[model samples]
Target: MSTAMAPEPVDNGGDARTRRSIARAVLANPTMVTFGALAVIILAFSALAPGLFTQGSNFVQLAQNVAILTVVSVGTTFVIITAGVDLSIPSGIVLGQVFAVQALKLLPLGEGTTAFDATANQTTALSVLVAVTAALLGGLIIGLINGVVVAYLRVPPLLATLGTLGAGLGVALILQDGVNSATYALDPVGNGALIAGIPNLIPIALVVVIAGFVLLHLSVFGRHTYAIGSNPEAARRVGINVERHLLKVYVLGGVASGLAGFLSLSYFSTTSIGGFSTANLQAITAVALGGTSLFGGVGSIIGTLIGVWIPAVLKNGFIITGVQPYWQDVAVGFVLIAAVWFDQLRRRSRDRG
Candidate 1:
């Protein structure tokens, strides 16, 4: 009789333990949700807007729309991984465009007469190099200021970058006299495709994403970045140069933003001085949505690449499905909030695990 009574096992925490294990795994690698979410979103949109969203040309157009964003987001991935933010992305982009245009203006040219003339609506090897270099250098300068202020002067990254954003935009506006510049020379970089159906921008973005993956996931530099972000004091104790590393991270972010601007100009064949106003926010959203913690210490460039498509898909899908375009922003806002909330849940899982 006693044996029969003992047959009923005592209540245990086995289920709870299983849950904690899963939560911990999710915490360790958070993008599972984003991957699932991306799939669900795509399926739902395809079902809801079959003809427009499912067409071949629309997919190509969508890729083109997000190409520059992919480049910007990869850089943002690095900064956010270190528990830092860069609000000056728009500034870097605009300034890069302005600098590229200025570089073009400085080049000697024949109007519509030579194959390699800026004035002839064509770009030469030298002009392309000068333009790209000037744009990249412009970004580096902005990044330097951001790094110095945050790392050395000890300003908060958010505040430091915000200040840089305002100041840099002012400088760009002043330089361009509030007007956008135009050029037909760099169109190939934007529109040309080595593959018959693929745009050049897609491959450029692919290269950057691959390079970023190597930098942030495989290299020693990434480990240090995670260490600093996870625990700066601990990182310092372990002999990491936190300040210098932060500076480098910010510089990389700046350069990426500048490159985005250059790409934007190439694609559009002009600069929108007032364009990209929300680019920094959009980029940060893509980074965060990709499961890179705003609180820092974890990230994936591949995840970010997936994240970049969410806003784009939502915008295109909503419009195609007869939903109001403004709902795009609302949908993205909710998704972002959910992402951050999930991040908090992940932290809790870590604590429990």
Candidate 2:
């Protein structure tokens, strides 16, 4: 009875398998890492400036602050997923704003009256709608041209967008007669808070993000985008119209940029020619930081959502903590580098496995 019983067998293989499965899951969803980092940053900021960072008003401000960037980043996400770069986003935003404002100024709402003049020839709602439509059309035309050049003409995306960037800015400048700033009487409506101290920009941004998620994750167009990005030849072999799909992706990006322009015009009640110079860089950086691969074929809209907020939170937190504005750029640069490095490491790990 006292004899030693047989030792229970160790389930080393099972344990190892479980561990591998967990690792695979983590690797498959890189957003987990970005989300974790965002949480940490928030916590750190809260700790650094407890009263300031934790305030309800500050959070609302942060939401309104990042609204424009979030909208633009959604479009940038699509282009990046296709392994294409668009340098024209900033120009697109400017164009949209300029177009909207110019339409309000030039379009004959009534006899010898423009939307800006408030002559009562047209209802405020109709004027806003018409101007918004014109802004969107401006963006659409630019996007279509970019897509045509890149997809059908076999031009590189970077070159095509860069060319458009210059051209778009020139057009916007011409429309404004080289004026650095232009304002409209509807500034209050455009930038006013709609609900609970939240600016109208927030709701518009939410709609864009939601629509982008649906388009990217739940639509056939999204599937083709991923396929084309992953392997164009394979996608072509499968009868996927690669060129047409690419064109659509660019157009979508353009539309998003246009939407952002409208929002910006509303929020600021003014269009500044040089105000959004850094917009393209910020959008691309946010996309990359959100776990979207610059090499294409791997991306997530949810990740982009989180990515757009991180920099915004950082800048806000830094200001509260008395950190210099320039340092924010430095911090963002490091984060960008770290994100790319992580991507490289992940790629290497997959290759080895």
Local accuracy by lDDT, each model: 0.87, 0.84
Q: For candidate 2, write residues 248-306 as lDDT tens digits.
A: 98988887888788778777778867888889899999999999998888889999988
Report model 2's TM-score to 2 decimal places.
0.90
Provide C-alpha RMSD values for all models, in order.
7.0, 6.6
Give per-model TM-scores: 0.90, 0.90
**Positional deviation of residue 131's Cα in model 2 after best superposition, in angstroms:** 1.6
Any runs in candidate 1 off by more than 4 Å, and if so which?
1-28, 111-121
Name model 2 segments beyond 4 Å from true: 1-24, 109-111, 119-123
User: What C-alpha root-mean-square deviation, in Å, does candidate 2 show against the real structure?
Assistant: 6.6
Q: How many clashing pairs does model 2 include?
A: 1
lDDT of model number 2: 0.84
